[model samples]
Target: MNSNLTVMKSFFLLGFPGLSPKYYRPVSALLFFFYLAIAVGNIFILTFVVCEKSLQKPTYLLFCHLALNDLTFGTLTLPKIISKYWFGDGFISFHGCFTQMFVVHYLGSVTSFMLLAMALDRFIAICFPLRYPVLVTNNTITVLCGFAWFIPLPLMLTIVLHTLTLPFCKSNVIAQCYCDHISITSQACGENINIVLVTALCIAMLCLLVPLAFILFSYIFICVVILKMSNATGRMRTFSTCTSQIFITCLFYLPRCFVYVSNTVGFSFSLDVRILIVLLYSLLPAAVNPIIYCFRTQYIKQHLIKKIKTSRFGIQLNLSFL
Candidate 1:
């Protein structure tokens, strides 16, 4: 700690530097819409899974976990940015900012692990159907999902704690929509910046790459099993079940990897462009995940349709009596 370091109470968030102040209302409105969509879509999936007894299997349980994680992530990041644009208030307390950083990274790590769990479930079901029931019990899935949520806490906390020890004598204005590890740590004034950054980067890579490698290998094995199936209809049916997860996995991982790789390689984009890329990958997948599940997964689609029709029939029956 330096003697000249100044203690600050709060930090300001500068969102989309290139955008005009006049556009703030529209941007806020748009963000609010997205937040609403993310909430409703993921909540619907969770509600459907919880209420339907037939959906209590390992795959749907994993879907519920992903849905819950997306809902939490969207809630964590979107509201403050929306308020900043809508009300011209961007000040977040010093401790609050670090807390946000911890939760954001924590949820991201949990999601990566959850996706790996999903991949593993699919791999077992497809690659070794006969053994799946014995291997992937409800208790087994519960423990896997439990570890996904629990295992990342210490790593994320370590990064946040390390960043906290650095003295931020520079500007308190964060150059992005929200507080994140890189943006927050960049404000520190010291020679220890590189060490902190490298540590954070290594932890990030570990959290991201390890599960991604497993997911890729699992899918490869799954593909091999699918190809070996002699019947064309059976092959198509087996592959279709995994398509929704595949779409979501690609959507979540590919853009994120591109963003990280580009940053590491010094591929420069304008500040606003980089922020937009982050928002695209972080928020878009959450909003669209349930839609993909509903439209792509046959059982969920049928169940949703049946529920809608039953509600409509009940409403019509009440109207006739009235």
Candidate 2:
């Protein structure tokens, strides 16, 4: 350890370096739109599910939690990243950086668990239709959702606490827009044994992969159950219900897994390119979940359509009165 290494008190985000200065505004505007969509879309779906009686099923209840988690993640992460490009305001104080990282990773871990809960919800619904009502209830889901959010807090907190011990006297310019655990930890000024990084990755994969395994396990049995359906119509209908979840899960996990595998294999990419890949996995699900999951759900679809028609009719009547 260099005794004279400058102890950094702050960090700067060097976002999308390859993009010319001339394009920062446009890029910022685009990111702003993404942030807006993520926030508005998720909140809209969350409210719809909560207010609409038909959407009070266990699966939709899980969707509500998922939407709330998405909203939390987008608010905590995307705005700061957007500001980096929008105003060149990339500097963040030490405490601020860690706080952001904690919220980002914590909600992300919660999303993984929520997705697993959704998968199991589907599995039980399809596999044991006769027992579905008793097996899956609002109380059961509420507890699972509670565990999803609660379990990750202390775990992520411990990681962040250990991170606070690392000296970051190195360059404060982070390659990515946000303070990710690995991205921040990589900048620490110490022995750099690499063990810390390895340990962090292992922990992340455990949090991410274990529930992913559960989702896969749920689907395996789900597929088997669907195949055993006596009629073609029933099979197609059952399979249709799983399509939205599987699609969103791929959108959420595939880019992440790609990044992990590429890093493991030393597959090199430019900073801008790699950041884009990381952002894809981080933000895409937030944007897609409302559309794919909400729109595809029959009750939500019908309710939204009905709501739109009534609102339009009210406007038309008001115009006539005018």
TM-score, one value per model = 0.97, 0.94
Global lDDT for candidate 1? 0.92
For candidate 2, what is the total of clashing residue pairs? Answer: 0
lDDT of 1 by residue, 162-254 (tens): 887788888999998878998998889788889999999899989999999999999999999899999999999999989999999999999
Which 10 successive residues of model 2 have the least lDDT summed?
1-10
Q: Encode model 2's per-residue lDDT on 1-322: one tens digit a residue.
A: 4442346778888788888988989999998999999989998987787788878888888888988988888888888877888888889887888898898889888988888988988888888889999989999999999999888888888778777767776678878878888778877857642666766667688789999999989999998888887999989988988788898788878888888788899998988898898887888889989998767776678888899999999999999999
Best by lDDT: 1
